[model samples]
Target: MMKILVVDDDPNILELVNIHLSQAGYTVMKALNGFEALKLVEEDFPDLAVVDVMMPGMDGFTLTKKLRTEADIPVLLLTAKGELEDKEKGFLAGSDDYVVKPFEPKELLFRIHAILRRYDKAVDLFIQAGPMNINRQSYEVSVGKKVLLLPLKEFELLSVLASKPNYVFTREILIERVWGYDYEGDEQTLNVHIKRLRDKLEKLTAEVIISTVRGVGYKLEVSSS
Candidate 1:
């Protein structure tokens, strides 16, 4: 059974999530705060985590940062504040997805399943774009004969875009495809990842392989080089 760790200060929220997740056939674990969440993570690694943004002693943002350094476990942030900046903060902190408060239990379950699907698909061994090669199994990328180490998200984002060259994918599409439909990060997250990808590719060729369409989205150019 897939294990999910849910961290929230509110008892009602935790119980509600536990009930839904349990019914969906997931083994649910609960933590009332970030400290307890961290302890739980150390004692027993979970397949995913759902964390509330506001908590006593170490907020969700800090917890996410700490978790990212040690593991690639998919994290979904829950926040009462539905501001764009809050979402951006969660993304920057290394959350894989987010959900605002006042959300339905069914919606949360769907988001959890979506995130798991994305994570599973991301494990596919390899993807190639022109001379560039990405080995998902090893989490390594190379161009021609040169090896390039990329951050986790950068690799996933590039792989998703390159997997379908010449297709323009909007920010929302990329987020859903690469980060999962539960992802609530701002479009700026995509821009940051794109910039990183471009910088890495610059080492291989002067020609830009990924092109951005104004008011549309981004696409990978079918390169003849």
Candidate 2:
């Protein structure tokens, strides 16, 4: 079973998360602070960590940075504040995902599963496009705590574009990459997928934009701000 470390100052939150994670078949390690969390890491490395932002000594951001730089561990940040700035700070601190307080237990479980799946491979099979996070392994696209379930074709199309943001990919190349060379579909098929992706992205997140380069093809652009 994969090991997961849960860090939060509150005993109630810690136990809540622990029970859920344990029932989900993960080996749970609990910590009340960053110092204790790091000590646990030193003794036994975990596959991932679920950290709360507000703590007495070292905050979640600092601890996340330490886990990322020191051990290269993936973190899912939990915070009561749902402001955009706080979310950005968590990402900047190298968190794999972010969940706000009063979140549904199912949502937390889903994000954890997605993060773990992304890390299961040798090479990182995840894409971070500003506020949007795409998991190639799980076919899940998340913007903050909102997870978007996409069709296989749409997910593959989005993944290809996100793999190289701002790089224009010709229609033929995209078709081949996503649908395979054996695909008998024409350019209209690609156009349909592009349209669907554009609609979804426009509705879901402004951070990631799918732009059509008239003559060339489509390019995915990620907002830095």
Candidate 3:
């Protein structure tokens, strides 16, 4: 069972999250403040943390930075302040995702599952092709001096192809892996994303190319030069 630490100043919020998470088959731990949460982590680290952004002493931003820098734990910031600045601050503080306080239970659960899925996908969690490095955890691709941040879907698509260089992935398999089984989009969607990726790669380096396999699908090829 995966352990999740939920930190919130309000007992009501803590209880609410605990109940929902527990019901979802996760071993849930609760803390009232950031200090307490950090202390708990010292004893037992969890797979992920759902943290509130408006605590008394250590605010959610500070707590998030601590959790990310010290424990390297993935965090989902839960708070009522649904402002653009707050969201930007959350991301800048190294939060993996953010959720407003009035968020749906199902949506919260889905986001938690998604974060855990990304966390569990790879051990190394990055692919290095020549000067380009595709980091799945950070969702950023760096080529030499330039770091490119692609959209989530584009990043996932690139990661999947780069995971196995020169190995052909058909459109069906790529769509299923990147967009999930229930992706209800036309085939043109994949083509658009692939074209975008190729355009970005062209700007980065000539050593790496996303090759088309004639009528099949796409493959990422890194030149040995």
For all candidates in order, the CA lDDT equals 0.80, 0.86, 0.86
Candidate 3, after superposition: displacement of residue 29 in Å? Answer: 1.0
The better candidate by lDDT, 1 or 2, is 2
Model 2 deviation from the true structure expressed as Cα RMSD, one decimal place: 17.2
Per-candidate RMSD, Å: 13.2, 17.2, 11.8
lDDT of 2 by residue, 1-225 (tens): 468899999999999998766544467999999999999999999999999999999999999999999999999999999999999999999999999998876678778877976877222478877788888778799998899999998998888787667777778667755776567967998999999999989888887999989987888898866
lDDT of 3 by residue, 1-225 (tens): 478999999999899989777654467989999999999999998999999999999999999999999989999999798899999999999999999988877678778878988888322377887678988778789976799999988988888777667777778768866776668999899999999999999998898899999887888898976
Candidates' TM-scores? 0.54, 0.54, 0.55
Stretches of candidate 3 off by over 4 Å are 121-225
Better of 1 and 3 by TM-score: 3
Clashes of each: 0, 0, 0
lDDT of 1 by residue, 66-172 (tens): 77778777899999998999999999999988999989776786688778878883234677767777787788787767888888888878777766667676666
